[model samples]
Target: MKDMFCFQCEQTAKGTGCEVKGVCGKTAPTAGLQDKLVGATIGLARAVQKTKATEATDVCIKKALFTTVTNVNFDNESLTKMIACVEKKKAELDPSAENYDMAKLWEDNEDIRSLKTLILLGIKGVAAYAHHAEVLGFRDPVVDAFFYKALVAIGSADAGMNDLLPLVLETGTVNLACMGLLDKANTETYGTPVPTEVPLTIEKGPFIIITGHDLRDLHLLLEQTKGKGINIYTHGEMLPAHAYPGLKKYPQLKGNFGTAWQNQQKEFADVPAPILYTTNCIMPVKDSYADRVFTTDVVQYPSMVHIGDEKDFTPVIEKALALGGYKEDKEMTGINGGKKLLTGFGHGTVLGVADKVIEAVKAGDIKHFFLVAGCDGAKPGRNYYTEFVEKTPKDTIVLTLACGKFRFNDLDLGTIGGLPRLMDMGQCNDAYSAIQVAVALADAFKCGVNELPLSMVLSWYEQKAVCILLTLLSLGIKNILLGPSLPAFISPNVLNVLVENYNIGPISTPEADMAKLLS
Candidate 1:
C-alpha cells in the first residue's frame, strides 16, 4: 500500500523518494515483486552452479536478472512467469536444497540489509553484463560461480563484510571477465570497430529507427530490412554500430537518429518512422507517438507489440513503409550543431594505437585520459558530463561509451597525436572495449591498470551501469567520480564501504572535478 526507497544521490531530495515509502517511486507490491524476482534469480544462479550450463539455463539467468534492471521490465505477469521458471530450475538442480525465502533479506536489520543490498543489487548489475556476454557465445567460470556464491550469501545470516566485501569486488572482477568475453564476442563477430563519422540526420525515404543496447536485434533488423528499400538508423547506444564491419557493411544501415536515451521522449515525437527497443533506458510512452514504438528481447512495455522469438519484424517494417520517413532527405545536427557524430573507437581501435597513446603520454603531449562514460538520464545536472568533456584540455583524450556520450559526443574535440581527443567506444557493454584499451595501455607502459593516467567519471541511471562500476572497483581502479546522481537503492553503509575500499565519489562541476582529476 506504500512505497519504500532509500534515496542515495543528489537528484533525489524531499520529493525524489517516497517519503513514507521510496524516493524511487517504487510501490510496496512492486518492491516485493522485485525482491522475489531477485531471490529467484539467485536460486537460478545456484541451480546453474549445480548443473551444467545450457542454453535454457543461461537464458533463464540472463533474462531473469536483466528483467529486474531499473526501467526494463515493469510487468508483474512477466516477472511472475520468470520467477516460476527459476523455481523450476532450482528444483531440477537440487531437489533437497530448500528455496530460500527472499523476503527475509528485504526485512533484515537496516545495516545488514544495507550491506546485503549492495552485494545483491551489485550482482544484479553483474548478471546483466554476464547475460550480455553469454548471449554473444562467451562464458566464464569465474563469472558464473560468483553468481551462485553471491546469491547464496544473500540468504545467509552468517555472512559479513569479510564475506560481502569480497563478493562486492568479486562482482566487479567477474564483470571484468564477463566484459572481456563480450568484447571478444562483439569484435570477433563484428570486425573490430574503426573511427567512423555517423550522422544524426533522419535521412529521407522509408526507414526504421532502432534504439536501446542490443546488437543482435539490430543485426536481425538490418537483415530483415535489407533489399526492402528501407534504411536503418542507429539511436542511443546503437551509434557505435557505424564502427562495426558486420552492421555497417549493410549499406541500408544508415546513420544515427536521435541523441541519447533521455532525449527520446522529445526526439521521437511526431517522428516519421517506427522505433525498435532491444534493451533499457526506455521512458514511459507518450500517447502522441506510442504507435511507432516496438520492443524485442528483454525490453517490454504494457500494450506494446513485443517482437517474440519469431522476430518476424513484419509490423515494424509495415510501420516504416507507412510512415515513408522524410519527404526529402532530412539533415539533422547533434547537440553541438555538428552535422555528424563519430563512433567505433573500440578496444581494437584504441589498442591498435597503443604505441601512439603511450608515446603521447610519455612525451607529456597527452597528460591524462578520462573515461567520461555511462548511461544518460533526464537529470538536469547531467550536463556536467558535456561540460567536463568540453573543458578537458586539448592535450587529454576522452573515451566514452553507452548513451551518455550523446551529451557531448557531437563536439569536434579536435585531435591529439593523430587521434581524436574524444573516442566513442561503442555501447555500455563495450565498456569491455574501454577496459581492454586500458589494460593494453598499462601493459605498454609496463604497469598495472591503475598506474595508467586514466580517470573514470561515470554517470549511472540503471543497473547495467551498476555492474560495470563494480567491475571497475573489482579491478582496483580507484578514484571514480559517479554522477549525475547515485542510485536511491545504495545505503549509507554500503556507500561508506565503497568510499573506504574503492574511493568512489559523486561528480561535481566539470571545471572543479576536471581540475581535481587533472591535478
Candidate 2:
C-alpha cells in the first residue's frame, strides 16, 4: 500500500503524486495525519450543512483547512489534536454526519479527481486568507458560507465534472472576495501601505526574525518588544511589514533578513537570533537551528516554542535577548546583489497615481505592463522570472508580488515617466491589488482587462497560488503565461479546457515568451 498520496504542490515527486514521502520534507505519518485532518474537516462541513453553522464552527473550519496547507504544520501531535477538535465540533453540529473517505476522491476518475482537487486545494488557499482577515476582526458571510459549500461538494459522491467545474470557478470567485476582504481588513486596521525602501542589512545587538503572513502577530510583537532594546526583522512573506505605517512606526523593526521562503534553511543556518513563523512555507526543522525556532498561529514544528492564542510573545522576546545577534553590523544583498529592496506599491499606492499612469500610457511613455508575480520555489528554471524582467523593454512596467519578486526585486530597473519601472505589490493575497489596478486601468482605457497591453507571467508553488489563478480565470482574463511547471493535479482534459477557454499555457523561454507577448 502507498504510505502517502499527495500532489497538491507544484513540486510533487516525478511530476506525479508523492506515494512515499513529500518533496516538502513531510514524512509518511505526518502526511497521513494531515489527510485525517482534512477528512475530519469534511465531516464538520457536512454536519454544518445539516444543522446551522455558528461562529465557532466557522472558525474551526477555517483553522482546520489552514492547518493542512503545505508547510503550515508538521507536528503530528498538533495534527492529531486538530482532528479531534474537528470531530468534536462535528458531533456538536450533528452526530449522524460521518467523516468522508479521502481515498474515494483520490481513486476516482482522472477528470473528476482533477476537478475535485482544484476545489479542495483552492479553498485551502482561501482559508488562509480568511483566517488572516478573521484575526483582524473582519468577516464576510459569503466567504464563510462557501467553505461549507465547497467541502460538501468535495465529499459528494454524485459530484461530476459539470458540478465540480463550476465549483472550481466559484472557488476562484469566492477567493477574489476573500482577498478583497483581507485587503480591506489590512488597510483599515494598519492603514494603506505606502511606498518605502527596506534595507537588506542586519544591525548589531539582540533581534528576532518573524516570517509568514500574519500582521497582527507582527503588530503585537512590535508592541511587546517596545523599548526592550531588541530589534525585529521581517523574513519571507513578512518582508512587506516594513512598509505599513502601523508597523514601520516601531523604531526597532529592523530591515529584512533573507530572500524568499525556499532559502530559509541556508540563510538561517548561522543566524544568532530566534526565528518566529506566523504562517505557511516552513521547511523541516533542522537540528542546527531547531532550538532557536518559534512558531505561532497555524505554523507549527515539533519541539519549537509556539506562542498560543493569548498572543503572548515573551518566549520569542526572551529568545531574542538570549542570542545577542551579531557582534557587529551585518550587511546583506538580494539575489541580484542589490543592497536594498523597495515594497508598498499596493493597490492603494498605485491607484493614488492612476492619473499619472494613465497620462503616461496615453503619451506612449509606458508601452506594456507585466505582472510577473506569485510564489517562488527551490526548483530549477525559476531563473526564467529573473531573465524575463531583465529583458523587458524600457518603456514597459513590471509589477511583482509575493516571494517570486526576490528573483529580481533588487535589480535597479530605473524608472519610466517618474515611476519606478518595477513596482512591488504586497504579498500573495495582494493579488487583489493587482486585479483592482487592472480593472481601474481597463476602465480608464475603455477596454477589457485582457484587451489592455498587459501580460501575466505567474509562478506558483502552493495552494495560495492555486486560488489566485482561479480568481484570474474567473475574471475572464486570458493568455496568462504560467510556469516553471503546470500543476500535477490538472488532467490533460482539464488543461485542454483551460487552454481553449482562457488561453493559459506553460511559459517558454523568457526571450521567446516576451517576443510572443509583445507580438
Candidate 1 residue-wise lDDT at 267? 90
- Leading candidate by lDDT: 2
Q: Stretches of candidate 2 above 4 Å error? A: none
Overall lDDT per candidate, in order of appearance = 0.78, 0.94
Model 2 compared with the native: what TM-score? Answer: 0.99
lDDT of 2 by residue, 64-136 (tens): 9999999899999989999999999999889999998888889999999999999999999999999999999
* lDDT tens readout by residue for model 1, 66-105: 7776667655666677778888877887665556666576
RMSD of each: 2.6, 0.7
Off by over 4 Å in 1: 4-31, 45-55, 94-103
